[model samples]
Target: MPKSIVVPEGTSKPIAPFSPGTLADGVVYVSGTLPFDRNNDVVHVGDAAAQTRHVLETIKTVIETAGGSMEDVTMNHIFLTDWANYAAVNSVYAEYFPGDKPARYCILCGLVKPEALIEIATVAHIGRP
Candidate 1:
């Protein structure tokens, strides 16, 4: 099946050659999102919780633009620049995904942007059983 790109309004232009999200066969594949402003500069500086919230909001926008919701998310790949921010990340994550959380894995690694403490890519199925 053919795929379509999903780019929500107000989303920052990607720094690289990739769409923010792609819709294929009822699934929305969201690109790894960072806490960056429209200018592509990292936000929230040293705060992990704020960064997580920003990333999730960006993901939400892409998913919704692709006709899906956070509830439809099936999996997530979470990346953190420091393990010290794990708990902070989790706290903000829980706020977005209240119950029946999606399957996810978190890793500690350096991000493309040093000031970006967290990045999350998501996969969600829409209108599929």
Candidate 2:
């Protein structure tokens, strides 16, 4: 049977109907994470770059909780309200994966939260043979 994992409470969330992660077939699927902090409040005030960093940090925590590291992330889906901020987000993203870059797709979309300019989710491979 596939096992589901719930990310710890203190971390950020999806802002609506979703768990942070689920582990199945040795692959961890993380939900899209916004810039929300431990208090469930938006962390980045007026900066998309800050918001991007915040979301990635939350994604990192989710990955770790699933017995995986950032390096284990095989794929990522990045949602952005504005593609113009790609460079802003990419700059911060580059810092996280310096050596091995995961396959990813970035798309521009409307976010349910007003303050969120970006959200990130990932699929990771864990429990290697």
What is the lDDT of every predicted structure here? 0.93, 0.83
In candidate 1, stretches whose alpha carbon ends up further than 4 angstroms from where it belongs are none
What are the per-residue Cα lDDT tens digits for candidate 1 across 32-127? 999999999999999999999999999999999998899999999999989999999999999999999999999989899999999999999997
TM-score for candidate 2: 0.89
> Whole-model lDDT, candidate 1?
0.93
Model 2 RMSD vs true structure? 1.9
Identify the leading candidate in terms of lDDT: 1
Best by TM-score: 1
The candidate 1 region of ten consecutive residues with least summed lDDT is: 120-129
TM-score of 1: 0.97
User: What's the TM-score of every candidate structure?
Assistant: 0.97, 0.89
RMSD per candidate (Å) reads: 1.3, 1.9
Q: At residue 66, what lDDT does model 1 achieve?
A: 90
